[model samples]
Target: MSALRTTGLRAATGVAASALALAAFAVAPASAADTTQASVQGQSQQTAAKTQQAKKQRVFKVRTEKQLRMAVRKANKTSGKDRIVLLRSIKFATGKNSKGGAGRGDLDVRGSLVVMGRGKSINAKGVDRVFDVRTGSRLVIKRLRLRNGAPAETESGGLIRSRGDVQVRKSSLLESTVTGAGASGGAVMNDGGMLRIVESRVRRNSSERAGGGIEASGGTTVIARSRLTGNTTGAVPGNGGALHLTGTGSVKVKGSLVANNTAGAEGGGLWNSATGDFTVERTTIRDNTAAGAEADQGGGGLYNDGGVLTVRASNIETNSATGAAGSGGGVLNNLGTLALSTTEVQGNSAPRAGGGIEANGGTTTVVASTIEGNSTGAAPGNGGGLHLTGAGKVTVDTTKVLANTAVEGGGLWNAAAGTMTITGSTISGNTASGAAADQGGGGVYSDGTTSITSTTIDANKATGAAGSGGGALNNLGSLAISGSAITNNAANRAGGGIEANVGSTKVMLTTLQGNNAGTAPGNGGGLHLTGAGKVEVGQSKVHDNTAVEGGGLWNSATGTMTVTDTHLRGNVATGAAADQGGGAIYDDGGALTVSGSTIENNKATGAAGSGGGVLSLGGTLELNGTNLNGNSAPRAGGAIEVNAGTADLADVNAVDNATGAAPGNGGALHITGAGTVTWANGRIAGNSATNEGGGLWNSATGTLTATGITFEANTAPEGPDAYNDGGVMTVNGAVILPGSGI
Candidate 1:
């Protein structure tokens, strides 16, 4: 029995082992199936969650106007952020509005919503605005074209009226208008909202008042990579044809364009009355116009009134202010602060003043900028490049003012109440063509207090009958020029380089070279002083100047001139008349003084020229420690001449003086017409005359007094040392050296 039981147990054990193996193989297949079922169930749950989230997101696709209205109403009812996607272009009719609600008039937005247009268009049919955002709502518009929207007769913003935060991206606003007596913002009006425009265009918009394209009040407006063009204001008086801001918020334009806009009053492109900052960077303002005829209406490009305006790396070009009394064709700072850096203002025109920029009663600063190719209109036009008037402080540093034209002040004009400082600048290729007697300044005109340092005024012309100061003119003010060069300037009348009239002018360490004055009959090639002014030149050089009367300097009856440590060289006087020649100086009824100065290589070449070095006609001429060398004249006075005046010489040297004409007299000194010449401790050497006195000549109405005088190497046909033709002569301690016959 034990043996049978053992056999059964062995069989059972074997069977149990086979069963366990079968169970293991089956368990693998069952677990694989269960894992597959669990994965499938998880995927189903995920799909259902995603579907529920999408339903809560609230996305609407609209094709017709009714669908769009329903989508907007549903978006307003939704809690979270909603999106309305436009499937096709939609046109809105002239619908009636019971009140300003969400589902009706203008598609009012009352919640955070995004309207995506997918390159489609929305037409308003010239009836009402396209969008009106409520106070607390947030609206975002993208890839849409909004056109032909006309707001109500009493409202602004034909396209959008936002009182909340709004953003527009890659969109266009075109042919929108607002028509009322005081309506504004033909395209968009942001009232106490944050308006952000990116890569959008606003074009061909019109408004009855201001802001033909955009108006922002008490909000922040930012435009980036956008364009505003072909906008127009009403025919009445308004400001800002493209953009107007009058609020306490800031406005910023970056990498944008504002062009081809027109205004009836001021600021054809942009007007900032915000009291906050208005900043422009890397933008362009071009081909804008202001058509007002009033004195306070101007600024074809930009106007800043009681605001802060900062422009950097921008261009303001081809703008016009076509009013009878308008100014600032490019930019106007009226009672505000303006700063321009690394910008260009070119090809601008104005009727009254400030063709490129105007600063009136404000602080203005320009650094590393170029103001070029600007012009002003006829007769009373002034300040082609920059005009500073009405009590302001202006600073121009490292700037170029070039190729400007005007009646007066071709480059810059500073009025009597303005204070200007120019440093490291260039004023070149400017022209002033006014025929009036009180107009001229090819480079600059200053009736205010002006200071110029390390500047160059070159290649300027004053091509008028009575124009003066080819380089600069200062009248009724104080002008100080230091370390500057005034070269290659031409004037039709007086002062080819500078004119100081009824003012106080000081020039120190400056150069006046290659200047020409008086194509017909004028004087003062380098410097002219008139109208009871005081002019002081110290440590300066005047060379290569040509004029009819005074090649180097001319001082009028009431002018006072003082020259100290200055050099006058290579000056020519081409007058043919007997009393109209002074190669170095012509002092006619003035107080002229030259101390420690050098006058050399001056020539008076004509038939009846006189005074190659110095001429005094009814004035007081004083020369102390001065040298006159290589001076020649055609007739009378190669070095010094006194015709109806008094000349006093102390420690003066007259060397190598010659009279080249036939019957010439006075190689070193000439006195005639009731004049007096006094010499004390002076030397006259190597003087030659063609006919009469080689060292001294006294006429019948002249008087000559000499004390301690040395005469050496004088040659003439008669009286090599001294000649008196029935005149009074008193010589004391006269040392006549060899090669002279007295």
Candidate 2:
């Protein structure tokens, strides 16, 4: 060949290689794409010429084990793709064993060969492996069965061991095993080679190490339209009962089923090592188990260890991780990147955290997926649907996490070092039920930095006696939520919609409605803050919530709460004690500031209920540009109350408040028991009391100071506009209605 002609040919080959490299990612699994390309390109010229000369393919017929062995020996000397047709079943004896070469323990093929079994079988007779394909060779088996090979003390592969390219079509590999230390691949092992299993079945295979059915390393492995079932691995701290992959390779599984596989350690169905890439599409992995003896071994269906694993349009269900502290009943990703698209993960269980999935480190993305019906079946279990921890970053978009159960964080959990971003998702029908007082988060729990947007959280329950946060909880971290809905959730104690405990929480453009915290001493039917937890609410709605105290919101002793441009309406407080009612807001010894907000149509029922709209119980209450209207109470302080606390009102409106009981007092504003009320630029109008002090009432130990305040349309039998029972009431720039005076 001329030099110019050779250069042209090399250019053409480069173009073809580029095209093939691009096609590999789209057409095959990441692991199996380039497996045989290099071998095909590196073929010797003599081998190519011989392949051309044997284009018709020399055929050898074999009906017995001796004839088959003879044909293999003859074919090894030839340099072409020859065919050996099996006319009948052949059972190999234990005597035909060799460490190397064709005349020894295993049938070793050193040339390109094809075995056409024609639906026949090759039984190993409890001896060695069936075939050994050497390097730089190719072997293809079709319509055959390889069974009952017990390879003792071998490195891997009970049925076949290949160092070249091997393909099995429409075949079965059954009852094969590889035992002892460092052994793997009970059926097939490909070392630095390419393997393809198409339209096949691999069943009842066992391995002592990894890959009870198949193991591929340093190359590509592809499995399509096949089934792997009833396989087991006694991998003392091993992985992959069905398929194991490692060493910078890629494995693709499409249109297949992996079921009923059991692993002694991780990955009952499939395992991907740190340098490998694994992808599953249009497949099912079900009824797999990882029953390891150690605490950190899990991933009943699939495990990705520092690898890139992608699952699309697949189902992983009915898997169990039943070990001490074992997690990720369906999938476990340890320091790896995992992506799930349009997949379903359901009916999985774990003894500890992450009943469905656990992302311990690295990044995990779930898009258009469903995770449901999973549980953690032990005390102190958490994250029934998904758990993210240890600096892991997770993103959930347009996914659903539902019907999962745990002692804490029934739907999902994010630990202190994790970060989660959720958008356009739904978390519902989950339960957090435990006897511990502080264990509760029915929909989600985050002790990390979390952001939720355009999500829905409803119909979740915290059913324990002291449970809280039916919708979501943020403890010891920062949580920001916007454009979400939290409704129809119930908590046995407090925070039917959301709870912030020792954390920073912000809610914007959200709706919280129809939630109930109805148990006795229940607080904050819509939101609760305790123990120095700071909260901010803007442009949100809190409505139709029921609680014993703070029907809409409760701010505990040491927290700071700020509300702006929000609405609190249709809330109810059913407690009968004077210290237990705040229909819209209760500042229980906390600094609460409300600005540009609306508090309306809230009620405090029961005989002793007080403060239908706002209550300051030994706390600082500051209001600016806020409206409190149409609030009713049966006892005292129909709109605003101060109980040994300080209230500062600026540009506020209190209107149409009523005390319906016969001896009710202060229909709009009340101060009692060493309380002080300072009103600046506010209006109190259309308020009615059944007895005395229709608009303002001050007790003996209380002090009322007013500037630029107006009281209008107040009606009562005595002290209609202002009443001071041995209390100091200093008024400047105050206007009284035509019917009453102070």
Candidate 3:
């Protein structure tokens, strides 16, 4: 029995040993650039004669500085050989090439070599590069600390320079420096060669121009599970404090971090102009800065000027671009296709525009992302979160844009030539504060065709007196919204929810509620329209909005507006304007048509105010199968007031409306100035006036014509039903008057 137990225990021990061996060196695949870290393979099971793929893996162990020099010389002499140099717990302060010839610092390899350190370090105290790989050679570094290099030129790659393939794993490169015009890559430089870094760290590198940490050109670059920290470039005109990838090489970075990087010009974290695709996945780039402080310099986190750039599951936060006219603190994509998924861009600031992202002349798509807490460092800029310009198409899906502040388009400012769309997203808590008017769209400012589907725009603001405020959306182009909600938005001037200027807006199956246009006296609480624009709302709700005038909707356009099967209710209009106050809707120009809709529970709460439910100043207004009820006006027209305009009400109900104070008239309907009202097949009942004209009141020069109308149960002292004060009243069908009794 004892012998059998011993055999079982031995079998279990063998399985355990195998598991440990696999777990120790199970390295993930390397990504492209910026993410590579140094990783060490588990100590080789055998020392000198270990077999790999049935080949003799020549290995050399160096325990002293002299031995290291000899080994490098031999490897270079035997050019095309595969060799591994192991540092057997040794430390070296190396300098110059083996032949004391060309190249920088320590050692030069003309053949492929793997330099593995057994918990050792190498420093090139005042030299250029610690190691340089020749064109036909390759260098692999594992478990090493390589630091203290000061290169004379950027191409020297302060610590390591490679003209061939280079792989670094489980290593650290620190305190490298480069000081020269257009010089960069303090830690490492890959010159038209492939570079891979895994499980390593590159920190405290300084450069004069770009790529304080790493620079890759032409060849493929992959970085995985690494960190590039505290890298700085260019006290003058730097770019890419952490990484720079140019030429035709592909760059891929995964599971990495680039933080606390600083650039004097652009791209504080990374700059890629590869023309051969760039990708970053599961990475974080935070606390970076670009300090040009001049016009047209930006990209605090990343700058992609060429190639297709894709970022997945990344976080870019707390970055700043301080150029006088700089843009894109988080990412600046210039003439490149940018695709992002599951990314968060937050707390980034630019002096001018695009605090989170700026896409210039390219197509961009963001899916399941978040862009929030971004702001312009200076005033008078657009697109605090995102800026799309020069014919770029931007599509956002399942994204959230929140708490971004700018002078215009706090969440997003889109002037792209192609259409922009937001599907199943949330845009909220954004603000646009400017000294000028019409420079605000707290949530989004779109100057092109924009489609919003299944999105929510709420709690945004555009603050400025005389400012054109679209608390939720400002559309100067074509806008289409479906299955969306715009609510709890505020503006200090106008347009609490939306503002359309010289644009067309279509709202379908959307809800617009609890919006405020102005805290004081302003116009258009829920929406503001002007400048030859068209608006249409169908199967939607516009309710509980507060404004100084036109509480629910204000249209002063030369185009047309139509609302069908929508509800406009619970709105309040309180201000100083006598003829401009409208609790539910105010129309100054453009044709307006309302059918199968309801306007109710609206109030005009100021002295000399008019139109508790609706007010029309000019243009043709038509109402069909609509209901206007439970409205209160302090001045006149508890339900509707018209001035110098045309109105047609057919099959509509005006009931439960009242005048709030004395000297008020027209509890249900009032027409003044050059206005004309024609009613057909409608009921005006259960209305009360404080002074006179319980049902209908027409001032001199006004006209009221009614047909198939029923007016009853209206209470007033002077006129119980209808009063015409020197105005034209032509009744073609059964009209009930106070004294006429029928």
Candidate 4:
């Protein structure tokens, strides 16, 4: 039991008066008063008598390493638990040629051994095990320095190996080297035992195989308020520069700094691989690296395989991996369950994948943490900050993924049938560049199923030589986007804002605004859906978006688009000799329905363009309570142009539309196909044209009907010689108007 725990127990036991007195005695410094001096004199006389009796019984102090070892061996051989072995400031010299040759020099302690430094140092040379404790012994090392001054090639085992419980408090382990063909802990190694280390420092340590600083296998180790830094693994394929844990062990680390540690293979700072559980709280893992030749593996800061790794209130930053296929510059979770809360992973770089975290065949959950400013360099990486692959499940709640860059997915990349759910989080300002000919996603690329709810996807850029979409979020599987905003995203090619390909996706109650798809020969400005997928957008707004063909939304072949209560407005298409059509919306070969929407103030200006507001090439458009107004087209259909499609307009209004052309015809609506255009209980008024047909121009043998509506104040060219027509009636419209036209 710890003294702090004992104090807490005594305080909890209702000895309040005695506990308060002890607290006052422990807190206040001893002062000399006349009455207190008399009481202190009386206590000093009793303490002198007890000291004389204690000196007469047995007072043995071991000062040398050989003397300390002999005393511990004698205590283990002769005495029981009642004996006390005292080691005070014992200098143990350890090297290849010092004291004796490197063998197992064990000091087994069966009784209680108190190795006290008393603000002094202890040097050990060529000592394999400074102290070994049996199952019933209690070894306490306080305020001691176990220094191992050996060459890099020599083999030095742990300073202390304990099978029983070991308590190391306020100690420092320095200048230790575990050479080639040997695994050494600079301070101690606990196998099937319990080790408690508090306020200790483990520095300048090197190991050949594993655990350069401390190795604990099949034990329970608790390290609090300690520092493990400047440790390295010297041999090839070595791991765990600062600490290593294997077997069925459990380790808890709190308020410690694990930094500047280097490993040859994996886990530059800490590694846990064997059926154990590691819990790290309020710890900092930074500035660590793993550099070698053959298969230098994951986690520049920490790596865990087949373990339960839980980290809370920690910081993992400025770590790196330098192998060919290095993963998880900060943390790597392979077949482990890693749960992190209130942690920060920033400024980490990986050569291969997952600059911040890489999880393969594991479960990772991050809540209220931040994974930002991480980068993966010129490699075929998947995710810049987080990579979730191999059937892993990643859940992020209220976390932030920002300013991370990768080749495939800038913020988060999910492949190989993994599941990622981001709720109330943000994925912003991430960049992805294509290496050769492949396109990358700016914010997120999900090759599997991904769900995002109540999140924000903004300001992400995907740029390269063959870069198509700057803000391209490519989805190959099921993508469900609800209650989110995708705004200010840029792309170089088609589907600038978003491209949903070969997926079953739905965007509901979302907003897509102010996105620019760069000048490329493609369609779908705000969103493009293709490859036999289905997209349903409900109660959303897609406005102020621009593309070459489709300004607000563009639908390609083979998809179902159902939009309700949406708005598509203030979009422009500008390109030289561009096939600029559908300033607000364009549907190529899909089933599109626009109901209760306002698609207005859109311009599609080009040499021979059409459909300033909406263009439906080959789809079924059912418009209900929609307003398509103030739209301008240079060629035809100031508000809408339909070719090879059926448009059913009910309770719709197409007003204040203009068409500018040498031989302008359609002002509000144009139907030039074998399609049917029916206007039931609607109005097409205040529309202007340069030539004729202020309301509509139906030319390609289509049926046009207007019932229970008015075409009032619609003006053509104002002159008898200017071919002005259709003040109240346009071309071939059956109107039932009760009032006269203006």
Using TM-score as the yardstick, the better of models 3 and 4 is 3
lDDT of 4 by residue, 1-742 (tens): 0122222223444577556434321211112232344355546676655544332222134445555555455445433222222335555544433332212254566766666665566665654446666776677777877776443343443566678888888988787766657665655667678888889998888777777788787789898999999988855557778888878899999999999998877888888874989989999999998653222267888888778889999999999877888888888887789998999999988888888888876899999999999888666776888988688899989999899988878888876589988899888898888633236677877778888889888888677554434454556687788899888877666566677776776778988888776665545667767567777777888888887777778776577777788888888665323235888887776777888888889988766667889877767777889998899878767888776667778898888987778356578876655656666877788888776666766653555565666677777753211121222222224432212122
Candidates in order, TM-scores: namely 0.90, 0.91, 0.88, 0.83
Ranked by TM-score, the better of candidates 1 and 2 is: 2
Best by lDDT: 1
For candidate 1, lDDT tens digit of each residue in 342-417? 9999999888888999888799999999999999887378889998878998999999999999988999989899
> Each candidate: what lDDT?
0.85, 0.84, 0.79, 0.72
**Candidate 4 displacement at residue 637 in angstroms:** 2.2
Better of 1 and 4 by TM-score: 1
Lowest lDDT sum, 10 consecutive residues, model 4, at 719-728
Better of 2 and 3 by TM-score: 2
Clash count, candidate 1 = 0
What's the lDDT for residue 665 in model 2?
Answer: 82
lDDT of 3 by residue, 312-414 (tens): 9999999988888878899988778889899999999998888999877688898999999999855458889998877888898999999998988889887
Cα deviation of 598 in candidate 1 (Å)? 0.7
Candidate 2 deviant stretches above 4 angstroms? 1-52, 293-295, 731-742
Residues 1-742 of candidate 2 have per-residue lDDT tens digits of 0011111122335767665333221111112212333246767787666445544345666676766777788778877567888878889874634464666567898999899889999999767888898998899999999998776585689899999999999999999999888788999998979999999999999888889899887688999999999898995656898998867999999999999998889999999999889999999999999886454568999989889999999999989888888888999888899999999999998888888998887889999999999998763588899888689999989999999998888998888999999999999999988545466789988889999999999999888788888888887888899999999888888888887887999999999898887573588898888689899989999999888888898998898999999999999888788776789988899999999999999988867888899877899999999999999888888898788889898998889998877358888887768999888888889988887788887777787878887889988777777777667676664543322346
| Candidate order by decreasing lDDT | 1, 2, 3, 4
Off by over 4 Å in 3: 1-56, 77-105, 151-154, 235-237, 293-296, 416-418, 473-475, 557-559, 733-742
